[model samples]
Target: MIPYVREIQFEYGACDQVSPLIRRVVANNPGPFTYLGTGTYIIGKGEVAVIDPGPDMPDHLEALLAALEGETVTHILVTHHHTDHSPLARPLQEKTGAKIYGCAVGAKAGDSAVITEAGHDLDFSPDIDICGGGAVFEGPGWTLEAIATPGHTSNHICFALKEENALFSGDHIMGWSTTVVSPPDGDMTAYMDSLDKVKARGFDILWPTHGPPVRDVAPFIEAYIAHRRAREAQVLKALADGHGRIKDMIPTLYAEVDKRLWPAAARSVLGHMIDLVRRGIVVTDAPEPGLDSDYRLAG
Candidate 1:
């Protein structure tokens, strides 16, 4: 198992026959080229299912294939089509004869994928679609359920292992920084709904696509929900304080937010602002403007 930044180590197939699965750190396109993601491998019944194949890195792909040796990869499950999480689906499929699966929907216009803020392009059109909330993959002693959790991306899905009682929470929950809710592609309402959906379900271990696995899920979910609510309140406060456009609100709203990530921070703020407008918490001249528009909280 290779060790990378943030004390993350690849434990080959520790979860199943696919023991010692590597966590290859690929370059995140947006801001500072930081490393993110924990690609998982589940080898069973002479077939393998690799989740979130991660970015299109030749070395990373090679590492995955090398780890597999002669194992046959049956499916490549994507949590979302985010560039960092799912870009390698095609290539990995090509090499392993694995089928790619993600949300049935296609890309939407004006989505954050167009911005290219991250050096990596997250835009994708899946080969196989898994729309339903629960799709099962049974093998050996495990049954994996694909649970649709749309919020960070419209097509995001989390996988749950019935036998282990673990949920492979893609970006829906991460150990590192908070997941970004970029507009159009990311919906705050759906995000909150999805979080509730997962929280309602009983699960012990959370195998997030990024960062380490969360052993204590209930508290984590509560903290995540509270954090989001707090962020919304902060956004509202910034607007009430006379901060207008997303750009203007960034400095005060995310004062301690990383400067290099201000662009992403702005996108998340836009998502909140849009939600606030729909809820009548904020007033705007035009519902959805191209750019540079003022926003103020409703009196």
Candidate 2:
């Protein structure tokens, strides 16, 4: 089981210093997907770099600006173009003259793909594209290296803080719950590969945008990888046992999950189906493997 950090101590609209180089202000937008809301991080001291400016709430904007009263925001770094994570970036930039940096919008943006719980920020295009990873951004006393991790979204990126040995993980990995891999953009194969990639980096800690930091790095990541592999095995077994459609397998596969979240679970299952088909382990009749498509064991 993933060691989920369900409770965090912080008031809405208040900035709290979580580390020597990081101060976070949590946005007040909480929901089923967003644990306590978006934790917009300010890295460094004098000239700071903001990671994930969060939703465009007027109150949140005011609170964030208030927290950085005398400091200069040199770079506004986005993890992805999700509405909840990056909508406030442009507005913050307009106020601070900070350059926005992150991955480009997914090529499948505005397509017929199923919209996940958190929607896309179609209007967001980063001033600097750090999607391919290995791009470094530094301020007064901190340096952040962007690492591409696409699964939760095609363009998701994580920022590694060299000074703190921590990674600002967006939705790629969360401490509250598993990330929803909605597709046409979210890919299970890519997600698994990205998980392995992050694990190999061996960061000391992970500070996800929506939850508290993941302090036990290695074991936590191992659990995530194991959970996904186990889920795929269960999905394959369901297909072999005559559960061809995604909806048909949900009742048993996600028996512990709330009914309201079944839709998101179905999308994750579809991601696995697409990956299975690509691996020649499964076959589907639709032009692309999707939630409604019938999947069967490859002959």
Candidate 3:
């Protein structure tokens, strides 16, 4: 079974009306793709917003149009500039003439930008800029506050629906597997800080760009926090076990990680190692250029 095809239903707003906002328009991403993200529909009074238009596939775009047959799209909000999520921004904006909004325009390391496996780039640029934190858009009855959630990407942003008490989490907090923290673009410290920031706000629901919606925010945040700490601990252990380099630690520390995704995993480990070095938990001669870096537990 494909990851995004699964149907998820959530009650919209404070009303008893349940709306099926997310529907899988297209499946399969190029490269060693394990899952395709769900295209989200935010239905409002007279206007609508589509979040993370997945890829630029014709069928997917057509499906999106079909889904919003009788509706008017006021804005196309991108959670992040990732290919799987933001590639369709341009094409969708062209089709609907809606303003595209996101953190910024650029590609990040370990992202699908360089690799065209997932889908072709739509090369869309938003009419209005919402990059810096606190940029907001107010619709008829709904308003979206673009919260700067950097770490996953330098320009990554998440949308918060003030009226609904909900948040469009993007890849920051997913219902499925843990998000890949690939660095150069992705920073572990920033990611951890973003999580804490969201937790402080206390949202009621999380409408992630992928997988199912997170109904409970507190416990979910706690688990995610714990998971990262545990991974950091594992990294420390790997260093103590005489694993001098990332390559040496891969098989022993991240043995269960997918072979195809090892590169991404290694980047994440490197990010953690960087953090450990800053805290004196680990010592590195110098910042590793790539993934190969000699590291040892601090005395």
Q: In model 2, which range of ten residues has the least summed lDDT?
A: 109-118
Off by over 4 Å in 2: none
Local error of candidate 3 at residue 226 (angstroms): 0.7
Model 1 clashes, total count: 16
- The lDDT, on a scale of 0 to 1, for candidate 2 is 0.91
What are the per-residue Cα lDDT tens digits for candidate 1 across 129-171?
A: 7867677876555577899998887788998877677788887
Off by over 4 Å in 3: 1-36, 106-124, 287-289
Q: What is the TM-score of each candidate against the true structure?
A: 0.85, 0.98, 0.84
Q: What is the lDDT of residue 254 in candidate 2?
A: 94
**Each candidate structure's count of clashing pairs:** 16, 0, 2
Worst 10 residues of 3 by lDDT: 10-19
Tens digits of per-residue lDDT, candidate 3, 1-299, equal 11222254432111112343333343234234324345454546446777787666676677677766788888888877667788777888888989888765555544552332333233545667677779877777777888988876767789888887888888788776567776667788889999999999999988776656688778888888888898888888777778778877777666776687666677778778777776778887764534666778888
- Tens digits of per-residue lDDT, candidate 2, 1-299, equal 88877678999999999999999999999887887899999998889999999999999999999999999999999998888999999999989999999989867966656676778888999998988999999888799999999998899999999998899999999998999998888888889999999999999999999988899999999999989989999999998899899999999999998787899899999889989999999998899887888889999
Provide C-alpha RMSD values for all models, in order: 4.5, 1.0, 4.9
